[model samples]
Target: MLTRLKDSTPKTLLLGGAALFSVFPLLSMLSAALQPQGSSPAGFSIPTNPQWHNFVDAWDVANITTLMKSSIILVVGVVPVAVLIASMAAYAIAQLRIPFGKVFFLLLLLGLTLPYEIVVVPLYYEMQSLGLLNTRLGLILPLIGLNMPFAVFWMRTHFMSVPAELSESSAIDGAGPWQAFRRIQLPLAIPAIASLAVLMFLSTWNQFLLAIVLIDDPNKRTMAGALQGFVGAHSTDVVLLNAGALLIMAPTILVFLAFQRYFIQAMLAGAVKG
Candidate 1:
């Protein structure tokens, strides 16, 4: 016991220090939010009189309700469709070994390396050509396509990890491919699906560049994009900026807390295994 404790002492201290280091920025932001709106304090100093209403004022001034609604709409539009399509594609490639499966999967892997900047111009032209610019469907469809490479890759890895016997058993019971995927595979892959949903939600919620470029209206952008709009308008108000940031961040944090166990499982099971 003594030897173990001694060995663990440095590791514990290291982890504690890292935790404090990671937390300092959050503490500083929270502290800044409590200060008077117009004042910009340099570091980690607490205010003598905390201006708690800054949050309330920030919400009203920023029209955060509208911004949140826009974000929610995008999340609902993108996440389910992306997850469903990706899950089905992964199921086909991983289990059924669709013809040219390796080539298709390789193309998606190549997409992982394609930067947004490289395709933004062409994407703009395509959206414009399809008369989709500035519309929610415009943003929704592109996000689903952009997310597919990673989502399909992640789900495919998870599906490949599942045992082949499940399919064989279903076959013995006279289940078709669609039936096997819907009944047996979907239930067995809940953890992977939940983890993918969390990731898609986070990415879609925080999407900024596409929002600014694709959607013209400030009212129609994601929360993070709306925050950028908020910043441009309220650059001089430090406290309001921080308050709005925290408000925008709350949903993603709640989602992560809810499905964190599944997220850890997904990571361990090679969600990003290229």
Candidate 2:
């Protein structure tokens, strides 16, 4: 017991240090954000007179309301469609045994290996040719495609873990492929689907590179992308900048915090099943 405790002590200390390292930047940002709007905060000193209204001023300056709406619209467009397609494709590949399923799965795996930057140039040209440049659909479509590889892989892992006997039983009970998928597999896949949706929502909400490149108008870009304009305009003001960054980060943080337990459960389930 003493030896076990000693081993755990080192691991616990290491994790504690890592946690502090991760949290240090957020603490510093909070410190800076609470300072007087134009003041430069040194290190991580907390403000004696916290300017809580700095966040309000930053919100107005950043035009966060409009950006939030744009991000919501993008998320609405991308998440459902992406999740639906990925779930169906995964089910087919893992359960239905579609022709050339292995080949298709291999293609998706290849997609995961490629960097997003590699496709940006060609995507730009394609969007221009399609007259989709600077449009919300332009960003939405590419994001869905970009999300597909990992999304499919994640759902596939969950589907593959489901016992084949369940599928066979459903088929014997007069259930068609779609019926079995909807009734048996989908119900069982709720945890995975919910986690995937949360992840996709976060990805869509925080999308930066594609949001900026595909949509030239800052108004139509994701919140993170809109930060480019906010930063450019208020680069000199550290307080407002940090406040704005925190505000932009708040939704994803809140969302993950809310769903973290379920997400962890689903991830553990996948790990054990896989």
Best by lDDT: 2
Instruction: Flag regions of model 1 displaced more than 4 Å.
Output: 269-274
TM-score of 2: 0.94
TM-scores, all models, native as reference = 0.94, 0.94
| Residue 263 local lDDT, model 1 | 76
Please give the RMSD to the true structure for each candidate, in Å.
2.3, 1.8
lDDT per residue (tens digit) for residues 67-131 in model 2: 99999999999999999999999999999999999999999999999887999999999999999
Candidate 2: where is the Cα deviation over 4 Å?
Answer: 1-11
Give the TM-score (vs. native) of candidate 1.
0.94
Please give, for residues 67-147, the per-residue lDDT of candidate 1 as tens digits.
Answer: 899999999999999999999999999999999998999999999999877878888999999999999899999999999
Backbone clash pairs for candidate 2 read none
Lowest lDDT 10-residue stretch of candidate 2: 265-274
